[model samples]
Target: MDELRRALQTRIEAGTLPGAVAAVASSDGRARVDALGVTEFGGEVPMRRGTPFRITSMTKPMVAAVAMMLVEDGTLTLDAPVESWLPELAGRRVLRRLDAALADTVPAQRPILVEDLLTFRLGHGLLLGPESDYPVAAAGRALDLTLAEPFPRTPYAPDEWLRRFASLPLMYQPGARWAYSTGTLLLGVLLSRASGVPLDDLLRDRLFTPLGMTSTGFTLTPSTAAQLPAHYQAGERQDLSPPSLWTQRPPFPDGSAGLASTVDDVLAFGRFLLSAGADLLTPSSVQAMTTNHLTGPQIESAGILLDGSGWGYGMSVTVRPDDISGPGRYGWDGGYGTSWCNDPATGRVCVLLTQVSDIFWNGTMPEFLHLALRCNVPA
Candidate 1:
């Protein structure tokens, strides 16, 4: 374990990453944690256990948990049409792909439900693919959305972004397939509307306070902001531009990809879901949240291949028993190189945190996680 930590530290020192923090824990009372490198390249501050990093889409699972809490409270239903709560989504339409242009085509076969967002079955895209001729390309052009670059300086406000989103045509019919869209952001909005509270406050009251995750939130304090590592691209320091669709403030606590957290704080969250301590959810709710809800292969191409490995409500389930050799191994990753997985079968969980994008799909982080899982299993 020490040797692996040293190797990881070497990679940080060699500029392979700005810095990183990792943790491994098991129900048998074995654990290891390490913080390596600097929060920013060429900066003197050493990464610590509490150093905050932008967790990006890692925010999804937390949002999903909160939504499920609402589900348990009877404030929301997984199968209820979202338009009942937010009328803006009423009269939704799909887009038509012509030879060279996009057109508003037809009303969806059905209205989008709250469950659709949890399973990512709503007619939306990640705004990066050309597979479906949804007006994503056009919307991206109109909205100036680009993945290769940082968010635009003068971005759209949250309400404005929602208005624009409501105006755009969906890529497919609701609940037809899994598409990785900004559904979580919509979920956040729905949460606020349903709970009659701000998104951040609701999350803090519902999940963070109970779980003791004090360091996790949508915005960082000025004190904590200094400790946040700068985002990077291709091993170089990158500018931290304002988001294109929302500011890091109230009225826009984006539940989709806006939040910062530290290793320890998130680990507490992992422990809660893994049921290492008092469980926040009933076993049936947990099972429902982690089970694959998508009916077919439509979700597989969108990266919700949870059943094959499996997918629960907001987390990804390990469909292949060999993937982690567990009965209930499930978790998710963020775009900013942060990932976590829990194996209920072995009573083990591993987390890797970084600020680089595209880490889970193609980076050493996933490989390191697999190695740690293999090594930490009790023989």
Candidate 2:
């Protein structure tokens, strides 16, 4: 195990990555954690066990769990139309693609439901793929959504931003297919409205406080912010410049990828899911959140495989475990180079955290997972 750790460390030292933290825990009472390289290339801080990281979309599973908790408590229904909670989504329209132009084709056959958000069928796209005209792209551009610049710090204060997002045409019919979108952010909006609390406070009161995730939250304080590792682009050794001052606005409480947390904090979250709710969630709710809810290759592509891997409320299920040659593992990755997976069949959970962008599911992540699995075996 130490040899594998050394190999990972050596890789980072040899420039395969900037720095990383990896941990593995199993139901059989075996665990291993290792930190490699420097937290910042030019800083003196060594990557440590409790280093905070911008977890990005890795926040999805936790947020999904919270939404499911609301469902279990009868505060919300998965099948309920989201527009019922926020009338802004009512009478929404879908876009019919036209060459060099967009046409507002028709009203949706049905209202967008809470389940759609969980399934990524809410018509917003992540804007990186070929299908760039998805609602999130249009909405982000229309509202000038940029996270690099600091904006109003209060939640839901960016009403004009959300209004623009609500007005954009959907990329596809609700529940017709799946696309990784801002559905999680929409879920955050719904959660705040339903719970009558700001998104950050709800996360703290509901999940973080109970799970002992003290280092986790949406907005970073100056002290915590200073501990944050600089984010780097893949293959680039230099830190990426901060976004323009004008683009620094906090657009909305994005449930998908807005939170920052530590590897240990997330390990507790993974264990909670694996144990089927230790304190913050119910067993049934956890099961429902991890169960596959989408069918067919509704949103399959080279980059995002939506069919072979099952998607639950906000998780990616291991449907054909053989397809990926992994056990009955279920979890998701963040766009900003963080990933966690729990293999129920093997009773093991592995987490990797870094500040490098676009490294999820790429060579860096796969290599780390390979080492973790190798280290999990008994001598």
Candidate 3:
């Protein structure tokens, strides 16, 4: 734990980041938790284990778990088309070319399956590189889909957001390739519609409550808001103030990137995954959620977003491990300075949270993750 604290403290002293909170547990029932540095670079408040963070894409795995619960209850099926629940997506169109106008398209080869959203294969998402400036991206921007970061909260409600999204053509045919972000957001709306409940309430009832992740949710209440630190970036003084967008319930409760949570809450969720759902989910369901579901060609097409990992339900599976990690380590990183992974082989669960978005790209995140992986399980 000294080594871990030293690593994080060095970064803080060097002005690389403000502060961080981390939690880890191993198969032998050993565990450790630590909080280091201040809430912000020069802020008075110190980082704490319970500090809430806007977890961005880390929300995916949790929503995926909820979907699995619905599946187990017979409310949804992996193979069934999602059109019955999200009629806006019933007749999707594919762009003839990414550069082509939105009107130039072919009908989808098949309706999108529930599994497509889980696996990010629904074919509609943020385009990367030059394709991001293509017609699809332009259409998304026109609709204010706000797929990428540095975004204000979207004003449209879930239904309207879906309607705007469905107006555009998909970049590829259904299940053709992995597209990031959009599928998970759409999945949130689908879940709400199918269950006849709002997404926030549904998630609380199904996942957060059961997992004891009381601090994890779409909106930060008065209690949790007090725990939210000021968000920061590498060069920027402040990315988001404490009482920011997260304090209010966004019109769209995006399952892809809408939740704020604490290190302990995220650790609880990771522990649940490590425990193979801890009786909340069947072993087979947990296996499906964590297993690599992408084919070789699909993985190749996903490129940098997936790097070498394979997409599972809504998280990345470590198909290709490095020196610090082994295969079957499943989890996702949040764009907003947080990461969570459960190593099934070693039975280790790790959660690292900070308010600094720069860490996600500035090498600090990778350094912390490696340290967390190597840190001894304190007896």
Candidate 4:
């Protein structure tokens, strides 16, 4: 753990990351948090434990938990057609080919199930196209969808967002391919509609309140906002507009790629999931949520960091263990440089927060993962 702390501080001093905070925990509730460096370059405000991180796609797991809450109560069923709750997705169309023109399409063979959203199998997602100017990127930009390469500042309201998103044909039939991001966003809308409340409010009531995750939310309070740092991409500072997006209400309270949280809050979430939902979910539900949902071929590209793991509801479940992390560990990383893993086998939960986009490119995140897992055991 001492060496781990020094490595993080060394990176901060060398300016690889503007700032970082991490929390590591064991199933017995023992945990340790580390914060290092200044929040901005050539600035004096040092990073602290309370600093809020733009947790990006890490929000998916929490949103997934909310959906499971509804499912546990019979408000939603796993395999049921989501059209009953989300009308905008009623009759989806699929593109004839992934790179085909917008007009080339076919009707969907089956309704997108509620399960598809949890499993990221609703087809369309941020497909890493062969080129930067891929058609999927252009189509999403055409819809003004805040896909967050630069980090989402403003967003279309949920209804308008979904309608515009639905305008693009799904890349494949429902459940045919394990797409990512879009399904989680759709789940936010579906859950909100099913519960008769906004997604933010719904999460606050069912997830944040129940778990005591007081510092987690799509928007932040003024105090919490003060602790956030500038975003970085490819080692350069990436600016976002309406700076208050973290402090106040955003145009869209995104379930897929929004939410800011502290290391404490993230560790709290890890604890809850490791505790088998700790009353927020049943043991069976937790098992199902953390279980691998992908088939043999679908496991190939769930993510870059978690390359070969099978995805579960929002996180990736390891089918085979890596060198440092073992199988049965589940969690997701964020585009805005945040990651968390809950290892049920070792009873370890590791969370790392930073402000750099594509933090994986620099190898710091993976190094941290290895160190943290190696240090999981007590001295």
User: Every model's Cα RMSD, please?
Assistant: 3.6, 3.7, 1.6, 2.0
Compared with the true structure, all predictions reach lDDT values of 0.71, 0.72, 0.85, 0.82
What lDDT score is found at residue 145 in candidate 2?
48
- Residue 73 in candidate 4 has what lDDT? 97
lDDT of 2 by residue, 58-104 (tens): 88888988888788788899889998778888988777742123455
Residue runs of model 4 more than 4 Å from their true location after superposition: 130-136, 148-150, 301-306, 376-379
Per-residue lDDT, model 1, residue 124, is 74
The local lDDT score (0 to 100) that residue 159 gets in candidate 3 is 87
TM-score of each: 0.87, 0.88, 0.96, 0.95
lDDT-better candidate, 1 vs 3 = 3
Q: By lDDT, is 2 or 4 better?
A: 4
TM-score-superior candidate, 3 or 4: 3
Q: Evaluated with lDDT, which candidate comes out highest?
A: 3
Tens digit of lDDT per residue, candidate 4, span 34-146? 88887877788888998888888899999999899999999999999988878878888888887877778899999999999999888877777553445665778767786
lDDT of predicted model 3: 0.85
lDDT of 3 by residue, 46-126 (tens): 888778888888999999999999999999999999998988888888999888888999999999999999999988877
- Backbone-clash count (model 1): 8
